[model samples]
Target: MKTFTVEEVAQHNKADDIWIIVDGKVFDVTKFLSEHPGGKKVLVKMAGKDATKKFKQFHNDAIMQRVGLPMQIGVIGAEKKEEAPKPVAAAAAAAAAPLTPGKLVSADEARFGDGFPYGDPNWYQDWNSPYYNESHMRLRKVIREFAEKELMPYCHEWSEAKAIPREVVKKVAQAGFLNAASGAGTNPSVASLLPYPLPAGIKHEEFDIFHEFICVDELARCGSGGLLWALQGGLSIALPPVMNFAPEPIKKKVVPECLAGEKFIALAITEPSAGSDVAGLKTSAEDKGDHFLLNGEKKWITQGAYADYYVVAARTGGAGMGGVSLLLVERAWEGVEARYMDVMGMWGSGTSYITFDDVKVPKTHLIGKLNEGFKYIMHNFNHERLGIVMQANRLARVCIEEAFTYSMKRKTFGVRLIDHPVIRNKLGHMIRQCEATHAWLENIMYQIKTLPEASQPARLGGPVALLKAQSTQTFEFCAREAAQIFGGLAYTRGGQGEKVERLYREVRAYAIPGGSEEIMLDLGIRQATKNFEKRSKI
Candidate 1:
């Protein structure tokens, strides 16, 4: 690399041939002036001057990695200063100290996530939190390492392919993630179905909802909802009902295979005519003595195109919510068909439109009691919504993290973007939303753990619904702000703005799937009012 003196670099500072020093590195940004997101005027002001302090204040290291380093022409040579050595006595005392479990010599010794402020949940980076312990921290570390190494590198590739490789799914199962996600690590019956132990050093007996929360949160950090859904979207929602309500034989046969990644299952409930209104589903399961004849079409079924089993909601009694029943329908049954559906986002999830015509479902496949499926389905919503909440919050953080990193390196007007008050305002709002929603989510998780099982369904339904809406809205806001910060880069897929673009597309997917924002708010208020009235009467 060529080296330059400070005076030599100063001579090249002009509009037609501009050079500037940032962190002792000289960059020939003359060609880039026209293409700068903040316009050419900003570069003109900093011509020939060292902008290291101004640069570091506004941009993250990502800016240098993505664009700054490539423009470097030479390094400025100046005498480097050496740091004073630590006192020998103090150093000797520090080295002689014994290592103890969970004891750190310094506050800076332990760090987590990407080290970006609000890039991860506050609890992740040594903040005192009631909801997490060393185990949760350990789980977060292992999961994040796994995601960075195994999944993140190919997340975009898999999203474009519109399907996750089967072997990857099997690998997830082998790692015990599938079992943990399927509620196996938390529920005894579900745990019994797992053929292997939980992930190394994790005890099934200690696994709680927060651990499950951590798993989904880490996966969401991959920044592709398509990949997260393809991996566990269907399994998280579909398998819970079976584990909680299915007959022993059905559980033994189906749960193990799914948990082992040998078979895939999806919950098929939404139809062309019915979505949030589960009671109005048109899929029918007519009783035929020994078997029920299933006939109907289910649209937007996550993982449906490749599933081996489906926990389907069909009409068996009269009409409305009372008549619905859950059934385990085999994908191989005659008249069963599934075709992939093209969608805006989450492409790799293999969302499908499924048709069932005169499909025979044995009586043993029925989940819970006849005409009581609505209750079971309603119960499952809390978990599904919670999963959505975790992913949305993380995706929101991904947006903020990406944009925050970009702002520091992306100069605007006469300074870095982060130095602008408007940019800071946007980031401030994003951080507040993410932190507030996450706190609510943690509070609810605590409630679910402490509340009686039966009371949870009625007590938490309203709050969970409200939190889901809050989370999706937060995600949408962050995605929008991040896109604005990146401008054109965020408009295209791949490169620095890839995650922002992908997440922008995925905003609606989260807002609409668990229940649309409007519906969630309304339902939340109604349920809360009803529960409050009942409690007051008592």
Candidate 2:
């Protein structure tokens, strides 16, 4: 925190004691000279001088925070104080004011992060939104801080390691995020079922879909699909079936441990022979007097290798969807096996190929009634698809934020990249798509919250399917465009374009999972056509 004049900094110009200033902060890079990826010569050239401009041309903020900050020695001058954000109470009061024809209602909510135009939601930039209130803003600040402090810094490391540390998982659970992740915002009944209090002191009575949305949005802002999937991908989808349909005794034993982060669980539906064709899955379970014998394989099961339990779908009777049954299978049970699978992306997610060779499952472990598993699986799709939609859209925005940051700092043809009309056009398309996708997601969330519980699946499934397709497509487009803007940096695994490179690799994961684009589009249109026919007198 000590201040130094530029002349004083320049005195340490020798390679043995080099110091440089970046963005008005002094860093002693004498020892880091050898460690520099660009080699020691680059640091030698910039030693004892302001390298802020040169630093930005090759690296982004992620590098400065993750690498340069550790070497920071002091500031160049008096530190500028950041203005405190407007209070949530004031924002709410402003939002409540009556609107008039010519005047704009400036809620002026305290902006989150750097004011990077559309880098965040409009509401994050002080725009008034009917959907959010004080609690939403409070939760947003808390979750964003949590993500930045706890998860963001280590995302790349975790992804490359192909596993998240056990301690980090425990930290998330202790923070009560695991319970929130499992609670589908569409289901109010979930409030009663949570084993832990909500984070940010959000009262159970006031917690709703938007709060859940904030959690998903903030978590995705970390910009690593592998890390996000490693953290919650399996738990969110697999735990719900157990929470909602498993026998009370099974729920009593399993739900608490999983929600507490003491154990892990995965949903096993996709087989080597089937992905979307659920009925064709060959996993079979046969009834015994007090147990069911389960035998078959489930491929591409997220978190399966680490899961202590699996909510498995197996054929219990004849054929097709009618024969399928969901059963809770313990990983420790005899003849159960899981091995990690090498995949193109989601490296930290622990994707696995699992086998059950005559494993005996207690009859009491059956989830809901026999032959009703198809309905249960279908019932979970809207929530699952919605989770995918939220993650995909936010990831798209990350591409925009990263690319925009790079464009402003990076020069091409002796001008910043933003000065080019073509680059601006690409940004315009990316921004429009991201914002549109977000608006649609919020609208869908509104419907999910407002609709009657019994009518939700039938009423919203088609729309949710369409939104999933839309979000994944938008994510792909943005990732590709961001890569183009970053050029060679996007091709590299780290540095200024690390996120764009990673996101480009992850595009297919979002598009193919939940449901493929082909299937989602067909399902969406077919459902809409049926609804149209039902309403028409023709």
* TM-score of every prediction relative to native: 0.82, 0.94
Instruction: Output the worst ten-in-a-row residue range by lDDT, candidate 1.
Output: 91-100
Please, what is the whole-model Cα lDDT of each candidate in the order they appear? 0.85, 0.85
TM-score of structure candidate 2: 0.94
**What is the per-residue lDDT of model 1 for residues 227-324, given as tens digits with 9 covering 90 to 100?**
88888887889999998999999989988898888898999999999998888999999999999999999999999999999999999999899999
Which stretches in model 2 have alpha-carbon errors above 4 Å?
A: 79-110, 184-195
The lDDT leader among the candidates is 2
lDDT of candidate model 1 versus the reference: 0.85
Residue-level lDDT tens digits of model 2 in 366-454: 99999999989998898889889989999999999998988888888899999999999999999999999999999989988788878
Q: TM-score of model 1 relative to the true fold?
A: 0.82
